[model samples]
Target: MGGKQGPQHPRTPRRRFDIMSRYWTFLLVLVRVILPLKAEETSACPADCACLEPQHHILCSNASLTSVPSILAEGTLELRLDYNNLTSLDTGAFLGLSQLSALHLSYCGLRNIQPGTFEDLHSLEYLHLDNNLLESLEEGTFRNLSRLLYLHLENNKLTFLGPDVFQPMDKLSALYLSHNLLTELSNQTFNDLPQLRWLYLNNNLLSNISIKAFAGPRRLRKLSLEANNLTSVPRALRQASSLQSLRLSSNPIRQLGSFGRKLRSLTELYLDELGLQEVSSTSFAGMRRLRTLSLRGNQLEILSLPLLGAQTELLLSRNPWRCDCRLLWLYVHLQVMKSKVSQGEALCSTPTALAGQRLLNVELQKLTCPAFGSHLTTAAPYKVPTYSATTAKRTPPQVMETPKTTTRTTIVSLATKATQPPPVQHPVPASNAVPERWDPCLAELISKVAVRPKGEGALMVTWSTIGEHDQVEVRYSTGEAVQVLWVTGELAEVELNQLHMDTDYKVCIIPLSKHVAQCTNPNPTQCAMSHTSGWGGHIQPVHMQPTPSHSALGTGVAVAVLILVLVALVLAGAYKLRSRQAGFQRHFDEDGFESERYNPDPYKLDGVYESNEEDRKIFVTAASQWSTEDEDKLDCRLATSPTVLSTPRYVTL
Candidate 1:
């Protein structure tokens, strides 16, 4: 048995070999991995600081340090030295931090930043110098930071900024310069920043802004000029055709001037607390796409109702609104808007009947006032729908322009069947009010209009009715109020007298449509009918006011109609000729796409390449990974500490 190997003895060598191999692996990990990590932590990070791994983001906030530490890692991407005592920055202070992408130096009592301080930070994107005592930045202070995006200089003591101080940061987007002491904004102040989107100049002492102050940043979206000394809409804003949200509140402005056509893209406009009174006829003339108009805390008694278009999120709180017949249109508008509103301070500070009550709480017919002037344009008493006792709670939803000279929201007349319409009531007319040109009232109604002399001052008007109706109303706006003359028989005609020789009117006939039940039905399929009680289409209304020489006027109109037909034919021929020539000239596109001339993909993307800035993560495809690190995951979250705001004069500090 000793000479021959037993079953247990044969496995001794193999088990010993396994134990030795495991021991060698443990020694290797301690020497190469664990020891090196400890050494690197001590050498790379400064004392009294926290260093995040992989990205090398150093957080030295609230450490009470007096100066910057010299031993910093070259691969550091972000450095937070906020809440320290770095009173000033010298030239080339961060010379070795070439890879730094974001530097937070806020609340450091920094009074000055010398030139060439950030000259080596080529990869810097966001720079925070807010909550400091920075009186002025030396010219070319940010010499080489070309990739900078967001710059925070708010809550500082900066009194002026050189025109080319930001010339190196062409890609900057959001700039916060609010709560500073800037008294004036010169030409080319923002000329070098074409990609700038959000600009904050609020809470400054800026009483003057040059015509070219906002000239360069054509794509600027959000601009805040609130609490500044500006008294009017800056003309420099005219160049910003892509401007969307503009804040000009609390500026002591008393009047609103012309908003040129270039501001048509403005969506949210804040004119609150301006104590405004006089508004030009064309104050909001070109803002066709305006969605939000806040007139809070303004000293105004009336505003043109036509200014309120569809889908508008209007804010009219804290204002003295006159809720009368002229303003009844607004009450109807609010009802239609339903829940897409935030009128926090919306209350009536007007006529004794509606005083101190919410506008929505008042009844529609109770909002009565005097006649409307011809200077305005808006809607009149539209077709009123009577709800059943339970229908008010069950009303589902509801969802037009009248004449320009006389604005009246009236619809088509249905030919009378049995009963005559009720007599006209003397109330406020929508003489100055009209719906938008594309409003449902006129767009669906005016197929034919007939008018002739019925008496010395009266004219007989007739229109095509929609359906047989027990009651029909001849809706016309030729007097102080929207005149509703009842037609007795099947003919849709009524003679309306000219109370004054005013040049304005449109024949809009509103038929008493049937009751449209808008209740919450358990079966949605059975209640598929629309929640509306009127017609909607695209058409033009007739305006037939007789001239002094009735005979010659008829002949001239015939000649004018013939000329218009000839011009239309000529224009069509020219367009066809030009299109054929352009098609022959087209061969290929920049994208190497081939298609029939004048024809492309439905999205028009077959022949063009647009890397839209709004598209997130949209890019061209790549075959190889040049670098392992993805910048999209970079830690760019800003600190959420309480920002220092210069309190308004009314509040006790």
Candidate 2:
């Protein structure tokens, strides 16, 4: 068999096995030592930076590092390089940080970003570049950051943004571009960001925006354009159906037209510090859901009641409201809803006497119009005596009408007498006697009388005649003196001045006949007076009331009282509820067995129990004979006794 040992494999297989073992040992050593050492060196933090290993957060804030460090861990999730001196972001600045979700480069002195600077940040969700010197961003700079949700570029010097600048960031929700130098926004500036919800463009030099600028973000909820140079409300805003808040403060808008019925979802609106002088009644017609409306610091003189909603929170401070008759409508409306208006801030600015007076303090009675009494009469002419300004006594004067006709009649008689022979005037035939003609004296009745306020201390009395008359006279008396004004038109007006502000006056319209009645004639006929039913005859009294003031005060007081009563009732109810609860708790405590059992008592040795005489004797005897054996026996007896075992009585000596 030894001979057949097969030419002696001579331990060749064993030698190969040994050689393989050594090779494996070397490979193992390389894997366990050399590879780990390399990994450790690669994972080391950059200079002047702090790295959190467990959280994989690298913070290099306030570091003088001129550029982004390349020694970040592969698993870094957040990188904060704020307050650094980074001038520009190269194409592959964040090349390997795939797991990074938040990148903050705020106040980094960053001037520009290359086209592909953020190409490798596929997992980034938040990017903050605020307080930088970046004038503009190259197109496609954030092309690879599709998952980015927030981008803050505030306090930058960006003058413009190219079309489709944020096209690749479809998931972006909030974009803040405040405090920038942007002059305008193109239609396609924010294209393709369908998920965008909040966009802030405040404090920019933006004077114009394309009508379709906000068309790309269909889900937008809030948009702020405050502190811009916009002269009016942008037409672009009506397209956002889901918008909830809009801010246009500190603009140059002079007026506000109706916000088309489409903005039904709008809740908050700010128009403060603008040059607004007028607001259409329908401006907020369809904004039913609006809750907050601010109009502080504007040039508004009056606000219509329909412009404000009942549930809306309004801010109307610093506006110049004229407290006059013209503003009576607003005043009454405010008085009706005094609780809704801001009392201290709603002040008047005109009518020197009312300047600086609060709208709530304005006297509504001070705004008044004259009252008029009208009567129509065609009565016969009666003696209308003329009175002096100083005397209330009246002096009668001769009544004359158609004096020219009388003069013409005398001239005709003289001519006839001169042409005919005087001796031929034998007894005048009865048939030749001249027939008396009716005079034109019936058209002297005033059909209508209208009185209106002329100024602060005057009244304008206007009247219309029912028929044609030669002359119409207006006699008015303020109880002290009577004045007559003769007017010669179908429609006549007399402005009575120097009249007391709040006093009653009697005015009468008298019509005179055109025919004359001579007082020297021995059998002179009296001037006939027409007693027409529709003619104004008697003097009508008109009362001039003071401006409406105290009534509004009474209304305000009533409303305040009602509100106070409601508040007091609510407080009383709350107090009653609290007292009832306290009473119930007291009753429960008085009736509870736990309170009585736990109450301290001087008669008992321990507060837990009140023992009888037999029980006390038993406890004293047990305590006097207390021992280890007795305690065991007692425990055994206690375990066996029905009441002791079942009820577990607590004994106190």
Candidate 3:
């Protein structure tokens, strides 16, 4: 029964939606048989068979075909059509070649390719179009090659790429678009290729990149955009979230600002040969994860804020990094991190303080204040000698010797200075002897003194308007009176000799009536008196010489002659000393005496000398005279040195 049923009817085959089934039966099978596409010898293939396939390669070497062989179609997986005379490729030229895996069209005369030229090469993996006259690519040109993994489009005149020219090759892994004229890239140009890893875009004219242009293919690891004119790190690279290594060694990035934020995933960042001077904070904020950072052959002055990140290895040699206080932090931190990091190259940039010093070997102590102790000492504020009453009046410093005495009054009134005693509180009426409220009585007296500039002797005094009666009296003294020469509102000077210099003046109050000038509120008289008389040095009246009697004149004349002779001797001695000192100076000036051996001899003293030169002259002159005297006459001769040879001495000149 089964045999009878099967004999008379034939059944139709069901449709297949499987891409492989449809493509294979409709395209591959027909292309393999009817096209008779095979080549045996590169030069002797049948006109119908594209070329005889020898070892599965249809080698149409040096083929003079102006167009591709129209009827040649087969399952030939590798096609070598090098040295061809083809100027252009038709979209459907290889329409039925489903098994073509490697296609080499190098050194061909191909000038242009239609949009769908290789759209039917579904199984093609490696396509080489190098050494061709191709200018550029149009969108959808390789639309059907979804499994293409290697695309070589180098050595061509491609100035730029159309936005979606490579959009169809979703599985492409390696691309060779180097040696082109691309200047910039658009965002999403590489968006869908999930399998791309190695991109060689070097040796091109790329200058900039869109921030999101590399936002695809999480596996993209090594990218080389070197040998291009880049003034900055590609913006697309900053957002290249999955990049592991980047090569931007040769560029014109003069400043490293936010430069490291881009390569968060970068293990190695090559920044060598860049023209950089300073690196700021954001340059390494994102590179806290970096393992190796190289900054060789750059123009850097110091390792500043940017280098304060955690890197396993850092290279900063061959750069001119100036080590200074500004670099103190980096200098010290580098040392502590040396043993922790590995394979790092750190070197010095200065040959003085930092000479031959590895950054890792320089400790913070070496840069501390102690290293420049002398400089610090010299720079510190110094203590200078200030003139105070206590200092100015100390033993009334030895007088400077001058030449002549004019009058007896000119003789300085000398006194044995006694140490002062602490102040004592006096009774109120006695203390009030010096009034506090501007002293109307005293003010009138000051007016009188102010009008007396024509008089030979005139005095004026002022006192502060505050303090208790006792404190006020003690504070104000005739000795502290400052004289106003021209009657200006402010006092000009304090004449210490105007009042008793060594006197302790006290006080008494007989009300305002005692003042030389009358007061508005006349109460009792008030006046000051000395607790001790002659408390200060005495003041002799200016007694211009008294007419000398005959006897006195004779005595005076003899004394004057003796004084003149002594002066002559002193002048001679001084001349001799000056000659000796001048001779010494000449020897010194002529280099006859070693300067180090010519230190001052403190034992050879010249009293009250004005300067080192004058002191030397006096010492030499006096010493020569003394050296000639006998021991018995030494005292008298020595005494003569200060008196006979001595210049005039004054207490206050």
Candidate 4:
């Protein structure tokens, strides 16, 4: 019974092993044959290209093929065919590539493409055809590519594009056509691209554009037209209501016209290198939202302050700005908004006296109006409104003629004509006779006071005077103590040696009259106290010493000596090495037996051993005619001795 049970168990195990072998054979056949056949049916890449599976992409760049390979992977998302020799594209060239999203055909020598060539690629979103030889595009060239978002046609020979070339790409967002031969843009060139945001047309030969050329693309944000032959600001830009940045540099535009009321959304306007001689005040009135305005590299001699917005960043460098009275208001406005103007780029380029001076460094007194000739007191009556302390919040005063009884009214009106000010008037005494008293008006004639650092805890204070004054007084405080100094001119230098370094100081200025000593009285009726200047000047005192000229000169001399010594050592070492080489060559030439034993090639010895008598005579004649300098040049070529042979040599003559 035990033997029978053992045999049955062994037979059962053998039966199970047979069934498992058959199952493993079926699985191997499915993996090796059925799965590959199914893959081949789904997608097949061309032999000349590489396919990235799972995410189908074909890479066939620089393959040097004449035509687009037809056997591309079936659901290919991207196909790279750059650097190929494809001269033209047929309608059915991409018949099976309907799933392609991006196509790269740059530098492919593509000169022409038939209409409806890309009709099969309905899902294509990006097309790169730059660096090709295409001269023109047909109206329906991109007929069915409605989903295309970006079209790159830069560096092509495209002289013109059909009006409806981009009509089918309704969803296109960006179109790059730079470095082309386009001469003009017609009205309907980009009519159907409503969603276009960026249009780059730089580095073209564009000289003209239809007035309605940019009427479309209402949602466009940026437009670049640099390096074109435009003679004036394009009137077509008025239709781009949503454009934020517009660059028109490197053009020959001589004058700027009003931007119209359409470009209200523009934030950046670049008109640099346009040869602009003048700009109308209304040229930028419509761009109230503009943040940056660049006028660099132009011929402008003057600019108006009203043309710029308050918060605009102005770039006016490299322009021939004439610094005169006409620009006084602009200089004052720039001073008030100094933080918004670039000091290094704000330079004057005209008027020989003020040329090369920074606009920020120009003093207010130096910007006097030459047209208003003579002093303000002698000029025509320039009305200046005066405010009373009690009626300061009231409306502005009206001009009125003075009565015959008041001689003081005539003098006050004449003085007020010259200055635009908060004038203060004094009551006249009834005595009508000329009193021997200093005029109180001298105290109110001071205009502006400026303070500059002079190192070593010193300050240089300069003020402009409008009327006669005896002296100028300066009062300063260091938060602990107050100090006063009296100076004699429109300019003064004060040394605060007592103040500590790096301490903040508050300073003010006042013009003093000759009656200042008498005005010190507690109840002086004839003398009045003058208005004190505000604390506009805050300075941090710094201690600095003058650089020693002798130390700098000594350093320069030491550097010169060291450089000379280094150059001399280099020349000396080179000379010694050359001399040693020449000595070794001379020594080798003098050893006759050694030269003959080592030098197997005698022709290398500068023709010392000629193969025939004719050659030997030619060499000797050339050597005898050589000049001394030419002979020295041949020292490395020629041996020292002419006959240094151990064995006798024979010529072929």
Error of 1 at 158 (Å): 1.0
Sort the candidates on lDDT, descending order: 4, 2, 1, 3
Candidate 1 lands at a TM-score of 0.53
Best by lDDT: 4
Q: Write the per-residue lDDT of candidate 1 for residues 138-182, one digit (tens) a residue.
A: 779989889999999999999998888988888999999999999
Residue 24 of model 3, lDDT score:
68
lDDT of 4 by residue, 1-653 (tens): 88778767668879999999999999998899888888875567776777887778889899887998887765889999999999999888898888999999999999999998999998999999999999999877898999999999999999997888998888999999999999999999988899999999999999999988888887999999999999877889878889999999999888786666678788899999999887865477546567788989988877763434555777889987767666764676677668877767768765555678987787767664331122211112225555678967655655456554533323323345556543334443443223233332233445555555555455555555533232454555564554555555333334334444445565554444322323222222212222222232365456676479977988999999999999999999999789867766775787755444344455556433446645644222212212222213332334121121111121111
Superposed model 2: Cα runs more than 4 Å off: 1-43, 305-307, 325-343, 351-354, 361-653
Q: For model 2, where is the 10-residue window of minimal lDDT? A: 518-527
Q: Where does the lowest 10-residue lDDT sum fall in candidate 4?
A: 644-653
What is candidate 3's TM-score against the reference?
Answer: 0.44
In candidate 4, residue 528 scores what lDDT?
Answer: 21
* C-alpha TM-score for every candidate: 0.53, 0.52, 0.44, 0.53
Q: Quote the positional error of residue 566 for candidate 4 in Å.
A: 99
Clashes of each: 23, 23, 20, 0
